[model samples]
Target chain A: MKRIAGKKLVFFLLFSLLAAFPQIVFAFPDEGRFVFDEAGLLTEAEKEQLEYMAQELGAERETEFLILTANDTEELDLSEYIGKFYDAQYGTVATNPAGTNAAILALDMENREVEVAVFYKAEEYLNAARRGYIIEQITPYLSEGDFYGAFSIYLQSVYEFMGTEPGESPETDPLLPDPVMIGQEEPSESIFFQWWFHVIVSLIVAGVAVALMAHHSGGRVTVHSATYLNQSTSRILNRSDNFIRKTVTKRKKPQNNSGGGGFGGGSIIGSGGGITKGGHSFSSTRGKF
Target chain B: MVIHYKCQNCGDDMVFDSNTGMLSCHSCGRRDRIEDLPEEFITARFTEDEAKEYHCQNCGAVLITEKSTAATTCSFCGAGVVLADRLSGDLAPKKVIPFTISKDEAVKAFQKWCRNGLLTPKGFMTGDRIKSITGMYVPFWLYDLNSRVQARAVCTKVRTYERGDYIYTETHYYDVFRDINLDYVKVPVDASKKMNDELMDKLEPFPYDRLKEFKTPYLAGFLAEKYDYTDDELTERAKGKIANYIESYLSSTFAGYHSVSYQQKSIHTNKTNSQYVLLPVWMLNYDYQGKQYLFAMNGQTGKIVGKPPLSSKKIAAWFAGIASGTFFILTVISQLAGGGF
Candidate 1:
């Protein structure tokens, strides 16, 4: 009975050790886990909450939503660091026949750099333009020190982007609030409402009014030629209108250079998605918070 | 030389009454047809001395008069006296337009005109500072003029239209020529040096149809002036008065052209005849802010012309009100168009 017990204990110990091995060895990103706040930017509770939400959303949409932060990466470039991190965790489509679909939001706290990188099937949905829109939306939040809110929005955006068709925009998501359109100038107030415009117009009107009053201070001449002219004897003795020449002038019509509206297709980074020297393919938009 | 029309009924001094168009006695209310008066009475007594000082017929007071004054009242007796010597022979007027507006009516019209001055000073608007009002017959030269106008010009009619991709402008050029003959009669030029030419010109259309042959009785009750300048001396001014009329008449013949550039234009105006005439005017002298303002009214047609003192404060307030109102309207319009806030 003692020897049987010993064997069972050993089997149980080995089972426990095997289960804990992945956590000990691979500390960056765990499968089925989304939030990785290496820079200590988020509270433990925030991470846990975001992780659960991302996990559920990722499963439903069939795309991995990631949030990553690092205090410093030494000499490693931000895009390079995220690319390497992605490559180590999940290989690209060429290497892994089954492929990985993921959208990664990585922040470098020390460098003040933020990037949205897409991998595998995510590249089809979150093209550089859509990624650019997500960045623009989250930047204000990040700048305002709303890390948790920014991350939550980023996860929601990625999930919504994946649910739509490859060529479609996530802006059409019914659950999302209306966004300020990207690359469009903000609508300005009308000139008629401007202070200077009113001043100038008023000055002109007042000047003309005053001038007319001053001119008519002396009465106008009431007599016209017809007042004294005798119509019976006065007549047009000779009148002639002879045609001389005709002239025609033409000007070419101006051309219209405005393109159609909506999201621009194809790749947006460097004319196409960038490829690392290590062969990790991604479409990304990067900026300072 | 100074003669008074004595009433045949009451022996009181008679004056020409514009309302009755007859010689009237103010004391007895007697009216007499001027035509029924004897020829000797109408011609009056003419003296050849051309005296600078004369005695009033009723008062025998030396009448104070200017060199150009043909008729005036006696300062001592308040009698209406006419200097018959000035109205005789070469100094006589051929026609006269009698004063239809009485003194009371003239003063009332002046007050009403003052009330209508929007920018005039507050004190000036009441018209209570009137110093004097005088009925005077100013001398003028009535001209019968003929204008012969010959003009040549290059004119064009321009039209613009649009096609699929281009804008086209078509211009049709024309050579226009006009020869016009125009006649203007009784264009009066003020011949008195004391009257302002511009002020006299403004009080026009003097009811020339009411003109009557001049008689000494017409000048009995009012101050009158013999022409300071002769008809020959004022002929150029009469021509100048009709120059604008001739030019406008020539332009009327070229009405259809869009633009005209005159190549050659000549206006030849000649005087067919002229006559010395007397036109009635009411002159009001007002004193305000130590400045004297002269206002003139046409006696026949009751037209008033003068410049009243303007109030700067009122003008400024008016400007501000108009500006703010216009601004508010413009803002509302832009808001309705979905532009301004």
Candidate 2:
């Protein structure tokens, strides 16, 4: 009974705990930003550079670009440029040193053929100029476009600008591996185990309930039936007529002796004929049966 | 003639209470049990044949009297019965729903509703300006119907390809078919002519299963009016609702089809049943600047719906307060982060 009660109490507590503490599954954290531009214009070389950058950074390719143009133009049509790039065999192009009239194209590497932006400004276009330089310096030797050269150069410059070593990676960052993230993973494992654990606990609880009910009935039957049998035997013994007759005969002589002396004087004739008179009262006949 | 016990104070007819199990006088607040009387009286359902039309002796207003009817005062003049209506007919309803919420609870609910109103006029919540509120059982028709719909539409799928150094477009066509079965579409139609149909429609859908049978005893603490609209009139409104559902369902079911042109659609309905149900609503009518505003409360759900007065000054002040708080918090955070505050 105690074990059963304990099991039931445990079951209720488990249910309450489950209801109170809901398990939350954390989603994968977002990796990095996808840079985007308003206008779409990309040469084949620019697209390759973006794909390589995405791979190096461990980020997904995003269909967005930043457009840098020479003029402050809100609207520019780049359909002809896009069509030409599609037909061209060479991936990269280098313009003459008069880079003021140059257009720096960025492609949406994820979608393959969508031109994201065209950057044309020269004076204030350090990133575009660097990218254009990297493409021009490597594409001719590589036969198509040198993605590794552009990616490595960009990463090296960003590391230098941030005052960090170029060899640093996220895997070795001490502060980035936060303790809270580690703590959260254990609870996720426990949640996965909870389904089977609860089933086993429920079976234990059911077994306990059955054991408790059986124990209660066992005590009741033994105690009640013993008392009932004792009462019935006592009633039958007292009702026997032979035991009553014996007990009555044992008391009869004593009762008669106590009454004898009071009437002895008047019954003096009782020795012979058992005739007795009290205060001269008339005595009549004798009868024998 | 049966002797009728009537109230001496207000002279209104006393009603029998089954909860307290006594005949209660509404006017003078007197109560007595019928079991205390010498003879047992069985209150019969008032029929048109057994009803007597009594002309009001005091005000000449016609009144109906039955076995349970007890009248001491006239309805119009508020005077004791001098005469009774001679041609009065049976006006008592077959069933009624008793008031579930008390007057105090209703007022508290109303006040809570007022506090929640984002835009309410100044002094609107003051005790002096708070108008007398009334609990009314409004009549409505609940309809259940089985609807079947058939629709046909022309659908298109787009395909693009290159032909001789130029992109060309190709379109494909296919016929669309939709068959649907709908059941127990509950549509509520307001029975009162004074109530706005549009407002009632917006406050849709009280759960009809919770409705209790009508008992006149429930009317003791409330003001109620019988429905004036018939079933036939409400059926017309139900048809309009069904038509609207058909149009929307057809459009959404085939939403994937590009450039869908509907050819033909038909909706058929059968096994329609309607019941006249009364629902409890707490009404607050206020007149502000010559315009009246109506507020309603769902008695069962306790959800209040209404339009409250807006104050431009309050709104501006609130917006400014939020902006100041936001700026202060951001400034503190930035300073802590070694950024220019």
User: Measured by TM-score, how close is model 2 to the native structure?
Assistant: 0.41
Stretches > 4 Å off in candidate 2:
A1-289, B1-98, B125-128, B157-172, B269-271, B287-292, B315-341
lDDT of 2 by residue, A1-289 (tens): 2432354356446434533432321222222222222233324334333333333332221111222211212232233333233223112224222211112233323222212122223112223222222233222322333333333333332222222221243233321222223323335333322434544544455445444433332112111111111222211111110111111111112222211111111111111111011111111111110
C-alpha lDDT values of all predictions: 0.77, 0.41
Q: How many backbone clashes does candidate 2 have?
A: 23
DockQ of each: 0.31, 0.00
**Which candidate number has the best lDDT?**
1
